[model samples]
Target: MLWLDLEGAVNVRDVGGIPTDDGEKITRGRLLRSDNLQNLSPADVTYLVDHVRLSTVVDLRSPAEVAAEGPAPLTRLGHITHVNHSLLPEHGFDATAEALLVRRKREEERFPGDPSCAHYLGYVEERPDSIVAALRAVNRSPGAALVHCAAGKDRTGVVVAFALTVAGARREDVIRDYAATGERLHLILDRLRSSPTYASSVDSVPEDHHRPRAETMEAFLEQVDKRHGGVLGVLGSNGFTDDELDALRRRLRT
Candidate 1:
């Protein structure tokens, strides 16, 4: 969506620098999106941590995935503070059919506002506080922070979209960012499967469960637009202000 196709790594890059409908660029490095870092090679992690100055990590996977995958590696790093905003319930998305069967309209209702989107409405409603939480955490550290879900799509995408929208990225631009995950996901899925954590998972997430596919994002994209009239409506509905959002975008982008 936002990120043009780049090689070398998946789920890496700033959500800023991408131009919005209003013609402003989102800048770069303020918002890094990706699949879980649990599978990153030491070298990749080192590069991101050292160069990007990774300061905080947001894990958006379900609790079942976390217990199965274990804590993300970055959490244990020197001074990084790890936060989990588990979006899906224990056996959710992995079994989309069942999720839909049980929560059909639930998923539909959460967008544009919280306590609705079947999987993550609650978090969206409460995330301005999380944004402030991240700001406080970064205040205690030095560099960048990363936001992720199992496949770096969906839950993580919504949060990334939320942050960018608040930061002044246009609504369409935010949708583009959410769409970019599909391209990035291909690069990392195989490596993630090799991790010891997956082997021990009782609630083993299937291959399809990870990675943000274009179709899935599209579904939410349409929903968000229809439900909230794009970024302004949904976020405004959530209580983030124009001035406060600008402050966040400026600080993160620069």
Candidate 2:
């Protein structure tokens, strides 16, 4: 029942208190999800380090976004960034300027952004190797861990969805978990959409930042199913061993 709500941290929530399909509840405070900590206030930082005691932070943003976050402690920084292209849009202004958000596979196929759906599909076909490596690194922990991306929406969603599925959540339940991100994050997204950096991050007008449509989120989930054949299917196909999955189940589900 422990939850930490740091004022400056967006989308911060414990994955505990949620139940698995077998009627087991996910232990709270163990696995957490959050938006970037770039603007964390002193109080927010203090609360994370002292109150919630998050000793590990698995940052899934790219190196550039990592730089933007100022400095990361060497000890707690997990190298699990960019593990999946499952639910994320194309990165930043590149996605918006060229309207390539949904054409992520092409971008991945090219090792850069592109608009063709085929190339994007090709790219997704080759992502399993890197993703497995990323996951292995960040899954270790003795304290609370926060996994995040810049916006904590797409990439973060995929991982969270995967975890939920492994913990025995149904696809719909996994998706429901992903969609919960918007609950307290509207204000933060609004602020970012209006910030000076907004112009550089997106091509759309700040006014259009209204809210993420349910359809939009649904599309990402659909991609996961269509592309990966389902979360566990994708995980197994991607080289996640049975033992590793067992570890995840043990560590993540209570």
Candidate 3:
């Protein structure tokens, strides 16, 4: 993971040069992952748009988040294609507090030992269509594809992991990439706390609770394997065709 030092988003990084199981490397500048882009400075925008040549933004944020946050800097750029594929259910942010609690409880029950893993699984189970569409957007990006959610942790991690897996990246490398966000948890939390859309939720939890764990990702992948055969299986079952997977692999691999 190559970290991009941007003023607004701390958890931005290029997931390039990662080795695949077949001895190939993921091409640099092809795919990037980031937290919210709501506060990006002009220079940061220039760096991403001009220097990085970012072409597509796969925003995994819920509709409520996008509406709450309003237009981001990237959204104003005429050349960039922004695709919103919320991995969570549409009612995610609009639900009552009690309803949210009930959903979280059900997610925990999905994998009693690891709530994070279960939550990740919920993305696949609850919104597989979004998952497939997000991957398709990445594959079709004209240049670098930047994937992001609120904190660039859960939803972003799941989608990026699926893309990496489809690109033939090694399992350990995928888990490592997912856990890389933990290194910037403090910055991520700070960014979230500054946003009215996420501030209250950020304050309600202990910071450590937000840290991404390698074990969680490992278990998530294991469950994916067991339940759907693998990432490709999950995508296939969700209407993502083999030809699209091949195109994604070709787009990501060197």
Candidate 4:
């Protein structure tokens, strides 16, 4: 994965050129991942739409977040298809202190060893439909598909990991890509702290806690393998078809 510098977003990157197990590489301009695009400047939009040929946006934020933040700049573009597939549960919309506490408790219960890993696992266990649908949107995109959430670390990380795994990318590379976010955790948190929709959640946590660790993703993928067989196993059990999986591999790899 390679980072893309943009004026409006800090964590935007192209998930291309990743090597697969069979010595193939993921094609550039086919997939991207990013933080929220609410503040995207006109130039950033032009670069993504014209230069990157971005065609689809798989937003993994709750309905309340989308509504709270209002329409993103890309939504104004007539040609781009925007799909919202929130990985959070229905009650995730409530951003209250109590709600956040309860959510964290639930995450700990899912995997007491690592709540972060369990949170990642919850994307598949609790919201498999959204996970499968998001993958389908990526596969069906005519050009590039950009998947994103608020900080582009958890929800975006999980989805991008699944995409790369399904496309046969090496396991270490997947974890590396997820951990890459740690390099920009400061910038990501700054952006989140500036937005009302996310400030409370971000401000309440320590800076170190916001960092994405390699072990978190490593454990998440290990559990996916242990419980669901693998990334493909989770998708297959969630109604993703074999033909669709093949198409996804073809779409991302060269």
My TM-score estimates for the predictions, one after another, are 0.68, 0.73, 0.98, 0.97
Full-model lDDT for every candidate? 0.58, 0.59, 0.92, 0.92
lDDT of 3: 0.92
Give the per-residue Cα lDDT of candidate 4 at 123.
Answer: 85
The better-scoring model by lDDT among 1 and 4 is 4
lDDT string, candidate 2, 41-127, tens digits: 777766777777676666666544554445643233353222322223335323453465445544555433222233323324545
- Model 1 misplaced regions, further than 4 Å: 1-9, 89-100, 104-142, 188-222, 225-243
For model 1, give the 10-residue run with minimal summed lDDT: 1-10
Consecutive 10-residue window with the lowest summed lDDT within model 3: 87-96
Give the backbone clash total of model 2.
3
Question: After TM-score superposition, what is the CA distance of residue 131 in candidate 1 from its true location, in Å?
Answer: 7.6
Best by TM-score: 3
Mind sharing the TM-score for model 1? 0.68
Residues 1-254 of candidate 4 have per-residue lDDT tens digits of 78999999999999898899999888899999999999999999999999999999999999999999999999998899999999998867676779878888888888898778988888888899999999999999999999999999999999999999999999999999999988889999999999999998797768898889999999999999999999989999889999999999999985
- Report how far off residue 186 is in candidate 3 (Å): 0.5
Arranged by TM-score, best first: 3, 4, 2, 1
